[model samples]
Target chain A: MSGIQYLFPEYEVVRNDDRCIRCRVCERQCANEVHCYDEGRDKMFSDESKCVNCQRCVSLCPTRALKIVKSDCRLRENANWDSDTIREIYKQAGSGGVLLSSMGNPKPLPVYWDKILINASQVTNPSIDPLREPMETRVFLGKKPEKIVRGEDGRLVTDLPPQLELSLPVMFSAMSYGSISYNAHASLARAAAELGTCYNTGEGGLHEDFYPYGPHTIVQVASGRFGVHEDYLEAGAAIEIKMGQGAKPGIGGHLPGAKVGPDVSRTRMIPEGSDAISPAPHHDIYSIEDLRQLVWSLKEATGHRKPVIVKVAAVHNIAAIASGIARSGADILAIDGFRGGTGAAPTRIRDNVGIPVELALAAVDQRLRDEGIRSQVSLVVGGSIRSSADVVKAVALGADACYIATAAVLALGCHLCRTCQSGKCNWGIATQRPDLVKRLNPDIGSERLINLLTAWKHEIKELMGGMGINSIEALRGNRKMLRGVGLNETELRILGIAHAGE
Target chain B: MKRVYVNEEWCLGCHLCEYNCAFANSGARDMVSALKGKPLVSRIRVEGDGRITYAVSCRHCTDPLCVTCCISGALRREDGVVRIDRGKCVGCLTCVLVCPYGAVAPGPDGAALKCELCLQNSCGAPACAAGCPNRAIVYEEREEERS
Candidate 1:
């Protein structure tokens, strides 16, 4: 009872008098009962603690009439912060724990956007107008062996694995159905069909509506394996086994029961309000051999019609890891870099862990080639692939293509506020609330996404044409065509490319 | 004691809340036709500086003044939530004029509109709180009574 006063402490709005102006806007705008104008007092009176900081009064202040600030109340810094910290602090303060937030990166790390540079064609080589030349931006994603020999029957069949034929190199990455709204998933699926690429159904499994777009979907099976079944397995063009995510490296997701709506619950194969926890480690696979068992099991379950992709978070010795993945009978290997997006992850994991996609791609390509198993599997890289240059760079560095999540969301009008964790997405891109779901027009969203990929495809083809490469196959692993500028000797050596102007 | 509050610094001005609130009140089973081309004015509003935004809703004050401010007694505080009596409201606009926080607004019916805490309009919990992915509009009651 002692802290009740502190928890529901009366809010007041105090003016310094030196900055007082009777604009009367605060009186007109405040949606809380903290402020009042007593005709007897003739001055605006406020109980500051009740202010929710909606800023209505602050913005409407004609002469800067008001400022609403939180009271400077401090809790003891225990250093060992936990739920107990919150309970104890609330017990002491006597009110509900205050919710505070910050969006995007919570860790200090180098953003390669500053390190990477874009090359524009100058007077030396002619930059063709994109409207004139018919650029070929078509990209195929799958395993390409060292050789493709014809059988005695005269049919073109060899030891190469099945691949996904993408109209464009860019495709949406795995974002769980529960993590984002149904409308968002619908938009991606519709866009993938219209644009002739694919969108991944993250570990959350595919919604029933997306079954029509199954041909253009890459369904994922993570450690949790929520919606894995015979029907779910056969519903997509390719199956991706997610070893890790870019944002929350080394950690798994916990879809709080609060967010697991009835539809989400059904899709994820869990009860409503039960925490859908995904463990960091897969209970079945302990080694590369064990991984191969799961791979073959999925292949057997799906009757070998669909290509299986093993996606891993980029880490040290990734090249060695890729070599093992190749021999594991996987059709494709997807390496997620550190800068990928997630629905909800601890502030520490999203920013602190994982390696750069560029570095991981280079190492994995070199390792597989050095092991002579490069032909055994294909590679797709993700985390954050922004533009056509990233797609081209990925191809040259041994990736068959690239997977993009944030960029796809951007095409659907996401501002990258990194507030996806908040279910109140004004853009209707994230959140499962029926009201928010209505905000997204799947038809419009899908079209915009298709338009963006189509635009990027043209740009990619133009770049490839300038390099005298007619097909994506010729450009794959052609690092000689790539030269680095502003990179140190170690980076150049690792990337197996010479410095620009060398 | 459960209530809705807004933190201005984090609001992205996406306006999903408004759409959600409108849909919850629209009474349509499908969302597309209910919201596609309507002038959406929610009981709650987002207010902020040009660079930042936060949502605004009724505080459901302990001793509600809007109920008293109503000249026709159209406004009443029920179960800690402020409600408007549309049938009784004569469109005098007295409640709208006298509200200290501007929480009361003229609805389409010419009656005052304020946050009902989604007691009747919301499908489940308050749509704003249910839809807030960030757990921002928490609907938990305080444990103790005020001094």
Candidate 2:
């Protein structure tokens, strides 16, 4: 034991003695083992230090007796050296390891989606009633033909390039098989199938059970190429080359050996109990030319029937990077913003690196337009697309579609406690342990996801109807429909939107 | 007829169904007032080891053994639900022994008690299925052969 304790427990578990029935449900449900019943005292107690405030015990408490609150305990209040900062320093000193975190960045930063406001039609233009009028939310992601051509017979040619059709402009983004549990993956796959959209398989290989959902899947090949195979490439409507993730932009992924169970190992084609380390960069890809080779190889491998997507993090030169990827023979370009969620990442890189997706999307869209290659590829922006409003805003800013992972997992029962590195997720969304994995029943999980997307589909229609837009295609890249509030001139210029009331 | 069924695969074994069943049938306005600091006499009970668990209650069979064996004529099948009349129960312990599922047990009043699908209680539906966190227990009509 340490001679002196330097840190205080962050949370206090409050149990109402009157309401508690001593059922001990909290004691059994908590994976952290924070709650215990003292048989001698005939009462329940909690070790608050171990509590992650996941609300598992509170949700399961039959009598509504438990509540977790932040402790008021402080250490010489100083804004310059906040309590969390000091505690983090102490933690690093004690453990001598890099600070790791999960989920999206919690730091207070500018959320452009919140600052941007959508325009609504008033007396001048009649807003269509979505309930009575026909509205189209369907979107297709792929390259559009530069010009129309006719055959020798003078009949108009209808053949177009391969495209991934989505009933709505939203998709369940990549959260690999190994990163999330099998039940979680099953839920996403089933929901995507039922919703007529797609879910990315991340860098992890596709599970055999999900093969029937290939039409609603987007197989990925990242740095490690963990599950990349001929059958795997052919099993999806599209393939994404994961150049970098928004969280920890310049680094790679590290799935600890402990989470690599036998099923995860088989799906990822890796040995059980072995750390799955994806290198920082794909050794074969260094320039746009190299990227073009891989794109063409994947296309050739798939009989040139599937569209290939190139995904990159929003960095300093994201516009130039997007331009290069568009010319690299990629059919779709996916840009992930700084506020993206991750299974596990170094806290330093997650909190520090990368640019916001709004600015990146606007910049890339304008750059492609100026280069006369706007139709060369489709643009999909991800990294914290929290709601239908965010989807509408992203589309107006020139995104063909939106990718959402954090929001999808939230529907599948993720509380975002930001402790995924520990792999003790009580919700069963992030862990591979059999007991926790079974906690998420695919039947309930899939139903919830379907409900979320269905609701969003309605909201997206209503928002578009208010804007006097009937289809998502007309809303795509229509920057005039958006205006910024409380944003500086530079911010407004970068986002390519006027100030509100202009 | 709609019957409460257990999937077992998704059952968390937290025994929340048992608590919900007890509280729903307790006839109190709230759970704290209903079953606090007292032994839980739940109509629906969860039975299993740590690996597997499922809630067990009356199956409401077409030919119930408890209804046929009730010596005091307390147990009866009403609208396909195996119900009991506590006023007529003699507490002979015969229903407890004849029941194959062990779903019947003596209540705190020394009367045989079993699940009546919450029809007699304030809850319009089975509380065990309604309170199940993982959808492990579902009250729905299925093919008799499948049940």
Candidate 3:
């Protein structure tokens, strides 16, 4: 019944007549409008083709009556031409357009976090309970003063420039206001404020409502300069120059005109309904010296009050790239791995580009240490840091602190359906639609996020306590507390961690 | 009519919706008593990689393809809600074959299971939406805002 149909639906819906109470809850709850009741027949019915298997109806059926099953609609059995592969090929042949996917890459690539193991204390070093001992997770990100300088009064100089102090060693990563819903930003802002951490504005500029959270915010400057202005540059506690993103390392981003609504338009200082394209590289920043000029310009614009963070995607030569950034007068360097997420990206670029954050962090840390400039700039690593163990591992790998977006969002309730590009999210965290966006009550979102961070903070402390480490400062770059499992010599050497059971 | 809007950005990949959905429909007196490691078979599911996460559930589209492709007379629509009658179903799964969102899945008895918006489950709305700590899964009516 179709002229060149797409991939067929994969499941069927079956309702039981004997259990037909006809409450119609499925009707109201379905966003796809798959379920409807027949008045003339006085019975409930379903259009199985529209069903997404969200199970909202079956779970709420009350009568124990609804079922969805895999369709027997299989293509002829062929290993070379599987159903999904054939469908994908047909889809490409039909549309002749690149398949764009939302979120991180779905390929079963290596995840470095799972392979690295954290060290624990033994009889040599007694383990201390975080609850009973003074285990510190708080970290300050910025330049630390070197050898003490004497003043005229022969007293140590306590004059230190601006720095970001995190109660815990984690800050919400850069996620632009345009990419996520206002409520999502609200939750993050509230959590950052409550947790005494910072949240990056991710080149979307600063929203009027969030300027009040400036002290706890890190305003970003990407290639597009969508919302960059004098006041915007001076607003946040830190100014981050986004050289690249982990999701699509070498490519630029184009926020389709369709998604650029009034709020996003205003926040980004761009014309409404206009495409927001962030170019791959800033025209002004062609070299490291040019990057230096930009950093200095921002410092001059903000009166050198805020720390300047230079964020780069973790590429093959990230260590060398980071060394230049360290000397470029940047206070902090943010390394984002390939596993990072995005609102929308070409499927190919997301899956096949960039390296893992762990390796990048290790290489950068080692390079900075070898250069004897490790203390000049703080290091922050991000891109899919799942649990407290990861945070611990990152610190031991030499990260001064960690920046997280996915985990932060998860605490607020993301399910990872990978449909963010559609912008019809039911939870309201990703969509700009008022009805959907309003559903995310920032109060609850903030509360849940706070709970998650508190839990992670507690866990980080416990992990640190078990390692016989008293503070997060001591844990930084302590590769002695880490071991590699099932990794080759090169990987272990790159990570600067010995193999397990060694 | 109201619908559940997914804010995929807020989804934590926790799969709480599946557990809550399962518990809500479990007909259990308490959530823990029914779902404390009971091989969850909830109507909704979570899908994601390490970086980002979101929930997958019924979208309840306007002109459903599942209805047009059903081999049996089991699939029907009335008052804008598409539902099914197992008694009339042949379990052919033609509906699943045509659904573009991949929202449809196999049920316990090899039947189809999906999100239907809580009409009889706990809470006046949906359990997944209400119990969602992040407010990622919201139940509401769609509006003509994305032009």
Candidate 4:
């Protein structure tokens, strides 16, 4: 059978003769069969083709004599219709086999920055200078409910729901410890506390080390319900019932045993690897009533202290589904659009399954308002809420707050190569490998995340101030202050905003 | 005879091989606690610009000079695999200065360590190849492109 080359061209281990100390560390430490000892030659012979560029031998040599560089190779290039560089390499190597990779979207698509122009305050309404004015960045996420009346004893308290109090509108989305690493979870937990918001412990149960950040954590209960005991239920201020995710809407995730070490297995309540599969749909939740039962069960289990959030992917019929969710007794409704992040997922589902958050949020908001149930529950949208502008746009479309994952990672120095499913994060934010995990300094990661959110919060405050709004509460559903620049009549109608220059 | 090969296109650039390489070389008992939230020191690396990524590690070549470059005889090729002797390593990083692939790295104890193909602990295979989710990096007796 024809196959890729069995061996690369032999590379010479070049050394600076001026720097040679005759240290034997390189011969003793190399893992590949690259180095050879020839007693007759009285010198070590190096085969360069075998070197992997790990830099292990280089760092270990006391005499500093080792250096591994890539051998010179040329590629045939035809810019006219050649596939991607990776695809071409695979074609050359795998004989034209379909190349597979793990985690998030890799394709370059159109970013809506220029398409969605930001409305600035001009002569009509003066923009409030954040330096001089009190710009409120506070946001509440949960059911607003109806009717808060005074009791017979004259103390104000009737029937208002629980909400997540945020000093800023942005939050850390659900990224499991098992999916990333224990240190990754710790960094998120600490940053959440520092930012006065919440970091989610995804389907992976809360690690014991993070229980102290209970006040700033959102514990998720997916269909698998891994490590979801009564304690895990009560450990967070809010409970998010993950119905589906944008990355793989109709599919569940499987953390292979090779990646699931002892700690991840214990925390997730699954055998080490063993194909931890979370089915596409909740077997028990067959109907709206069934969803209501689960929602009430969680609230009852936590004595109503924690608000229950129903997290659903933004599918085509999201408006109707959201209307049902609003009536299902959930305190918050979190909709994930198609472009969400995941540790691993099928390629087809990530790019094709769910709808855009913009459309879904607008539709859901319109439906709930039309049904007079807008006050029943709060809304949170995820699946690539990229920047402060996206957050503001979501709020204009009736989202209370936004859940950010990729942005959070970017803050922590993630280049968004989308290889998270491989479980080896070069930056050490993801992956379970002890050595790779150490690459991420949690103190630095947490502080960087805090900085990102802090800066975004200030930007959000400035945006709100320009609209003549002092608080996020005032901006909620206040679409009159927004004017669409490039949107069509339908887009403007759906967004509940007037056309520009109207 | 021992070698490492990467299926570049299949490589997701996740860097799991790097972590696995680092952990396998760390000599730590608890993998999770050792790796959690720490800066990485892996013997292998995922190489690529933003648009393309692939795992790059030691290939364990037929004729090796890293062994010849070691003045202390700390690096040796036994049978078909390259092995590092930490006891004699003075942490002078001489092998690092010579190898073309940049494969040699420092150990946790400041000694020289490279991909030993997971032979020391007899994990049966290289940890990076075993742990890679995409099967991008593979360890075998010969580098044959499998269809």
Give each prediction's DockQ, rounded to 2 decimals.
0.02, 0.84, 0.06, 0.02
Report the lDDT of model 1 for residue A133: 61
Put the candidates in DockQ order, highest first. 2, 3, 1, 4
lDDT, residue A276, candidate 4: 73
Interface RMSD of each: 16.9, 0.8, 11.6, 15.1
CA lDDT of every candidate: 0.73, 0.93, 0.82, 0.75
lDDT of 2 by residue, A1-502 (tens): 4777777899999999999998889998898999999989899999999999888999899888999999998899998999989999988888899999999888898899999999999999989899999999999999999988899999888888899999999998888988999999999999999999999999989999999999999999999999889999999999999999999898999999999988889989999999999999999999999999999999999988999999999999999999999999999999999999999999989999998999999999999999999999999999999999999999999999999999999998888888877888899989898888989999999999999999999999999999999999999999999999999999999899999989
TM-score for all models, in order of appearance: 0.64, 0.98, 0.75, 0.66
The model with the greatest DockQ is: 2
Task: DockQ for candidate 4, please give it.
Answer: 0.02
Better of 1 and 2 by DockQ: 2
**Model 4 / residue A500 / CA error / Å:** 2.9
lDDT of 3 by residue, B57-103 (tens): 77777777887887877776656656766577777777777878777
Model number with the top TM-score: 2
Off by over 4 Å in 2: none
List, residue by residue over A140-220, the lDDT tens digit for candidate 1: 666665766788998877654667888877779998988888878998998898888899999998888789999999989
Model 2 over residues B1-147: C-alpha lDDT tens digits? 999999999998999988899999999999999889889999888888988888899888889989999899989988888889999999997999999899898899999889999988999899999999999999999888432
Decoy 2 TM-score against native: 0.98
Off by over 4 Å in 1: A1-108, A113-132, A153-160, B1-147
Candidate 4 ranges with C-alpha deviation above 4 Å:
A1-103, A106-114, A153-155, B1-147
